[model samples]
Target chain A: MSELFDPLLAPYDERRRAELVAAYMAVEHAAAPVPEVRFPALREPALRRTVAAMLALSGRTLVRGADRDWTSGYHDDVAAALAADPACVLPVEDRAVLTLVLVHSVAIPRATGTLGEDTWLSPYPAAADELRRRSQLPVGELEAALRRLRTAGLVTQVKAGGDEAGGYVPGPQFHRLTPGARRRLQEELILAAGPDSPLAAAIRARRRSNEEAS
Target chain B: MSDEWAPGILARARARVTGAVSVPAAEPVPPGLAAVPDGPRTWLLPSWPDGATPAVLEQYELAPMPLDRSGQARRVLAAALRCCWANLDDAPWPGVPAPVPAVLDVYAGMTRGDAALAGRWATGELRRLADTGWLVLDEARGVVRTGPRTALWPHEALGPLRDLLRRMPGPSREALGDE
Candidate 1:
């Protein structure tokens, strides 16, 4: 179904929906090391609209952070629509597992020098193990969430492991993110992870090398 | 307006654009030989030039829409509509009914602060796009879907966009698995 139609969230009462939207936004705009929401703000129409727009455009949501007390990360669609349209919004729930997935999809590529031309993909069990390390959610719950992300088109299964097991790569939506949105995300990473961070350096060196190669 | 009524209101507005004519699916192409060669001689068919397909041409025609008041509003609506279309899995494909409230959420999100005003803008834009026959709105069902025009968005037309997106850097680089 369209990301527009979220059955999991459709049945909630209006107030609860409002609260979830509010909570999602708090972490989305939070500037702390880890973003969290204390009281869901009921008065921010712009924030609400932003979330709706992001969800509408991308079918992804912001969830509470797991690695940190309160943090935010793009769950599905890998920030494609939000990156394209900076005016977008996001979701909250299954915070840690989803964050781990997002980090795995978005971050780890450069860290491992596996980005560009050939994307480094991971098997489901490997992702599950990493997610288990970061969050308190059980294996089943993490798998369920991963399934949900796949259903949402945020991540796609790839043919790997020679039929023994399949791996995953970023979904089609990941490639749809706008350059501006991608740049903004990179800036955020540079600030949080620092310009001298190994991943950042890898990314820079990759770009420099690619430019020189071309 | 209270948050309670926002969704309902958006749905009702979308219902206003309901009803559209569906076009027939495109025709299939005939199969042909890849290439042929005989005794150091070769015969080759000229390659079809890029942008020669109907879809590409149609997309090119629709590409330069000005992003003014209604223009910008219409684009936002289009994005939401695309999502509505994208989410149609197991619902008999692209003709799935879309919730107006969901489509409006996209516009409302972008406009922020004044959802009422944004709703008005969206309603007006929807009507306009509907009038152009590019979008079909089912007001009674409170859903919307792409009109016949969108069928023209050929795979080739999106090539450049896909390339650009592929080249863009991701947000982070934290390793998650041993692989």
Candidate 2:
């Protein structure tokens, strides 16, 4: 919101460019049950392991793959990283934010594959929330952010559990996250799992345990 | 431009109405681009060529765009432009032969679709073509302009676009049905 913050972001913005940075992060990274991934369970190391296992598999794809599937790679990368609780501790860095936006936000890649244009997913509420939290900023501007993402086909009003019946999940509406939206989600994941990433080795160990158990 | 979804999204909507005319011999778009029954009639599509500037995508009724980062915006705009051009151009003109400027301008006003972020810079580069002519728009029929142009067609140019849909990339190319 403040012009001051905009200039400060320049350096961070420059560093986090490209759609397929974490090329190794893949959707098949964690073979654990998708439905089993719950927020409260995220606190448990065992469950976190399951998530981490999945995350490690994904990290490879993000860091290694030449061509990435926006839907599969993005969802896998973000889901695994979020489960590791990147937001809870380090709170998702700007680099990770860019990763999330790159893969998850179709608006950006959709722009790239066609027009040599790429509109990142920084405007996303989840993305913005994560950014504001890391920057230690407040969440005063809701209407403006929501309006832009919605129009850009990035963000949507997420109706959680109580908002629906027993069949519904307690998360944002699927919102038809496109290939472009994947870019946004991926950027966030990358930031959450940087070079000194705590989630990396942690996820590997979890996977090792799961493999041994199985 | 308005942020409300534009008309002519489907075959019927794009048909010959009292005022607007549809291209003749146009085929029904495959399900991926024109699954009329499944997808919403309204969509916030990104305008092409010039990137999806808030102003451009807004023109076609898409709104609530995130406002940050020129780099990201430019990339997304490029992708959206490709999607639109790929589908709308029934002929699929690839890389227009004329100079980038005049071709882009005519493409913009003609396609009535503005994803041409490149047009802002390349407008002056296009040369007037021998057969291409610019038709002034009256109230009913939007004007038609021909001659040297900018922008890529993805396919061969069928001369000056005879109809609104004619000037556009085929609907199947938009990847709408893929959704």
Candidate 3:
């Protein structure tokens, strides 16, 4: 088979290729899911080849996540470059959801007395409840808002043990943040929740141990 | 410079960075900071006394990585990475650690024995990758995410493999254990 041949995408005109690649490059706000194509059309080898060539030439990578659907991300180099100057351009709802996911990943465990990081997984119903409690948005809008977050790669849905519908957690893009950034965000959470916060207590405990050891 | 406790201190520091664990201070001084003759009582990371080389921090950047070609493990991990790649147009979330069991669950269709082996292989691979700065595993969080140094891996190297996977028939592709 030709090196350029991929069996999963349609033949790419230069305009179409540019549009797709440019779309990915412009996503400085958040990660976005790949646009879905009908299986039959995408199954054509010639089309897939054209698509793969476009992606490779443009330095894009095709990936999948908890949603079990294909998505795309810029190559690591491109992503790092874009991250240097990210803009908060996501829609307000998306921004809100992303913020909640970020805060939830770090704060939820402390709030619920779940010490483990895995408890960061917030179920859909729980998220809806939280949103309702905080923003007072109708419960009906919660699913759509969560879906928007998922599409933006800020939230991931994962199986909740034996639960059929699953739950939400910080998605792949959340992990892309620098450690300094994660630390800063956690610090903010602690401040808002007060020094008596569980996370604060955890930090204090570590510091105390260090002092005693010294 | 020749402190016997340097290794232990360094290990603790790395854990603190990668796993978010709170590490206790080393005797007389904490790791990652320069030794001060009359330093203040409070310990702070990223502070260095004048003329100190910050050896522990420097060593982290230059640590030697052991390359192990455990094919099954690589295949399993690569598959997981590919999934995340397909799902987002950015790097997988560094802050949120993915659950290992959930990752394995996606490939549960494999033969039970192969699936079991894949789990073991994945554990070994994750540890190796974590050591090499390709991945971070938060034991307390029970989650895994890409490491800070993930950009160091060759970006275009997986293109051909991804292309081949893309061309596989749907059912056959499904049989590969991708959800």
Candidate 4:
């Protein structure tokens, strides 16, 4: 049984172990990124590594947010591996709806130079009316898919307020994505939304070079 | 537990986050999940560390995943629990399956018999609960059972839920067609 113990976590007492586990749970379960200050256990390098190891035992990665917070999410490679099984992926309709929202909320604004952030979250929500107009799916199917997406935390509905008509924005789940996953999503969006752009060409070139190097 | 098992474990873990993953009952359970064995197949339900639940998001004024008509859905779930969870000593999952009408009857009892509109709403909520894995609705048999998620409810949290369930009135006799 002693041999089963992880050396990193073995240094901590039972109470301290519980605290670290609690911190991991807090980050893993929370809908949004948890502030680092809220859990002092996470600040210790050893405890942080232990938590990362624990997360890895189940195929998760601890995501360090730009805002000095923490969350847990799947690594891009693991997700890609899982994508080989069709049952593991989002349904095509759901994927289509999500792509449209991303294009409208993130890609379009970035292309027009109105959004400056490198992250997926955007203040500019994609309106339902516009999505309906743009989608090839029937209005009923689109509406149903949007409902499912909202419930799953992939897209959130914004109430109509002050100068802004209510619409949908990428939800808190985006915050759970690791940096690599976020960067890959950005590249995919660029490729899909502006395939003719020089940035897309550069992305294709980089992918080719990386493949050759590997 | 060699390094070779890592990819398969990771894929199952990722798949489980959004939906239930069924594995062979004879297989060893994955790291973060609790197995609910059902004959030859086992459903993997993700387990969280003690004292931490998704409700923690509310403490920071952050919304958890959105639920459509959450109140109605929860009430319907409660009704199902009241009907299926006959033995208070046992955990909620793998509870006795109850007929849909029986669950609906209990739901109606909870709401003081606003039967027509309430019945429709309850039916819709039941379907939604089934979709989200809160309840398993066997449409062909018209039976409902608690889903694996209920088993994840912390033991301490069950006390209050048990009390609330105890105080809840059972299915109305007239609603059950007994003169």
Strongest candidate by lDDT: 4
Per-residue accuracy of model 3 over A1-214 as CA lDDT, tens digit each: 1122223223556555433333322221123332233222123445444443444333344443234323344445443333443331455666566556556555766567664442323433235445557645566676667765664456776655664544567765653343344454566566555787787888778768988998
Give the TM-score (vs. native) of candidate 4: 0.88
Among residues 3 or more apart in sequence or in different chains, the pairs in candidate 4 whose N, CA or C atoms overlap within 3 Å are none
lDDT of 3 by residue, B1-179 (tens): 12132343343233323322222344444343322221222222222111122132222232211123445555545544543344343434332445655545443433256767766766666665665444566667666665544332334544664564454322234333356
What DockQ would you assign to candidate 1?
0.01
Against the true structure, what is model 2's DockQ?
A: 0.02
Worst 10 residues of 3 chain A by lDDT: A1-10
Ranking by lDDT: 4, 3, 1, 2
**For candidate 4, lDDT tens digit of each residue in B72-108?**
7789999999988888788887888888888898888
Tell me the lDDT of model 4 at A194.
81
Report the error of model 1 at residue A139, Å.
Answer: 3.2
The 10 consecutive residues of candidate 4 chain A with the worst lDDT sum are A1-10
TM-score of chain B of 1: 0.47
Could you list the iRMS of every candidate? 20.1, 21.2, 22.3, 4.9
Question: Estimated TM-score per prediction?
Answer: 0.28, 0.23, 0.28, 0.88
Fraction of the real A/B interface contacts present in each candidate?
0.00, 0.02, 0.00, 0.32
Using DockQ as the measure, the top candidate is 4
Error of 2 at A67 (Å): 33
Better of 1 and 3 by lDDT: 3
In order, the Cα lDDT scores of the candidates are 0.43, 0.29, 0.44, 0.78
- lDDT tens per residue, model 1, A155-182: 6655445655444444433332333445
